[model samples]
Target chain A: MESIGIVNYWIVIALMMIALYIVISANNLIKKIIGLNIFQSSVFILYISIGKVGGGTAPILLKEPAVYSNPLPHVLILTAIVVGVATTALGLALIVRIRSAFGTIDDQDVQQDIERN
Target chain B: MIAIELVVNFTLLGFLLVTALYISQTNRLFRAVMLFGIYSLLTASLFVALDAVDVAFTEAAVGTCIATILMLSALSLTGSRKEVRFRRKNATFAVCVSIALGVALAIGIMDMPQFADPNAPANLHVAPYYLQDSYSEIGIPNVVTSVLASYRGYDTLGEVVVIFTAGIGVIALLTARTSKPKED
Candidate 1:
């Protein structure tokens, strides 16, 4: 039962690893940004998973007494999700700048252009 | 009852894993971006299953909606429709590093309190207070809003500033002249 309970964590970890691999290995700037978004989303899942309670409902008040999942993580992640999008937008903006400057977005191509200059 | 919940959780998580793998392996930038949107939708669904409705709502809006739109716009601006198909010579090194870190993290996870355990330290520290008192103190039906808007107002303010700064940064970066330098 304990192991079953942590299955989400295992999956989150796997997702994180896959995203990390993409970020590290992918040469395309846009693909790397996509990988970073995946990594961020997986981390959000891990936090929400930690906040889950077996018999809990959403963290909304009710007339009748009820268990609620931890709301703190939800609040934190609410901020994080918005911030993640902002970061993504900024990253993509930089990618656009890079594309214009170098005429290519591939990591190796950009590097070779730098060396040739 | 628990059986069904577990099944749903497992199935959703399995799909998430597979989608992440697919995103990692695909070389088509557009395909990867589209699949990433699917990934975010699945993640939001998982958040719903975890009883974080507010988080799920935000994830759906920001992740699936805003992020996808931004990525697609970026794709159009950058005009790189396809990724270079060269084999990654360091792929083996990257895999080894990911696996090593993943195993270490898994070992660390073994010591974590069982999921959904009521007495977990994370559940104990200050969460109970917000959960129990936010309704009475803030007069809001949603504990998350009370905590976010009332208890953690400053943090949200800070987040807003960060977002504002990011917006400025994006405007500055995207609007700057990219014309080639003229020889003196």
Candidate 2:
């Protein structure tokens, strides 16, 4: 089934693009950040999904002959998740500071005000 | 040859379109944040469908949990709700970017190997040994762990540095005074 084949990957990519559009198009800073998080997440899924081999077993490397997933993607994804969390935390904290310093979170307003100053 | 894959792909595509519409049309900030969280969750599910347990775990943890929390925190920093308007100039910019991305995607799709074909070069190289002998070679039952910590140790190091730098930057940004909170 062609559906079983490349379609899943395309679906994943579409989700990613939607998230990216939200991020780029959203005027609200927080929403934009939210969009970005979704975007990154979909990418993560894309990478993880690509690592899948049909009927593959886990990457634990059994002594007996067996099918196993590529472990590298799994490990890499673990690191990516950690990095994603760190990035989100940092971004949120920055938003907090931005609110306190600027008294607003709308990007255009921030820009206009800066121009005014 | 491609029936089941087609159905699953279409199903996932439907979800994607619905989510895009929701995010684009939503007026409420809180709702948008919540929808975005749902979006992450679905993406995580996609990872699972892809058979990437480690990546799925991370997506669940980072994308659904941590990222959602951060977005909520950001919401707190901003006003509760307001009129969300998409400016025309911004729309134009988005369209241009979309067109550019479309072209790039077309190029990328052209260059890609046929979907999930076992004979694809990616599946033939390096992967066979890693799958078959990684545990024996590295003495770690978790072949993923072996590959990450042994074969690709330097990659891990780079990740560590990136995270540490981000942490430091966040600390610097959040610091109100010269004082610091001790890390546990």
Best by lDDT: 1
The global Cα lDDT (0 to 1) of model 1 is 0.88
Candidate 1 regions off by >4 Å? Answer: A1-3, B181-184
Best by TM-score: 1
Query: In model 2, where do residues sit more than 4 Å from their true spots?
Result: A1-5, A62-64, B1-13, B177-184
Local error of candidate 1 at residue A97 (angstroms): 0.2
Per-residue lDDT of A59-114 in model 2, one digit per residue for the tens? 66565877665555677777887887788778877776766666677788778767
Reference-based lDDT, residue B57, model 1: 91
Give the fraction of reference interface contacts each candidate recovers: 0.78, 0.56
TM-score of 2: 0.85
**Candidate 2 CAPRI assessment class:** acceptable
Worst 10 residues of 1 chain A by lDDT: A1-10
Q: For model 2, how big is the iRMS in angstroms?
A: 5.2
Note each model's CA RMSD in angstroms: 2.1, 5.0
Compared with the true structure, model 1 gives a TM-score of 0.96
Q: Tell how far residue B77 is off in model 1, in angstroms.
A: 0.7
Residue A111 lDDT, candidate 1, scale 0-100: 90
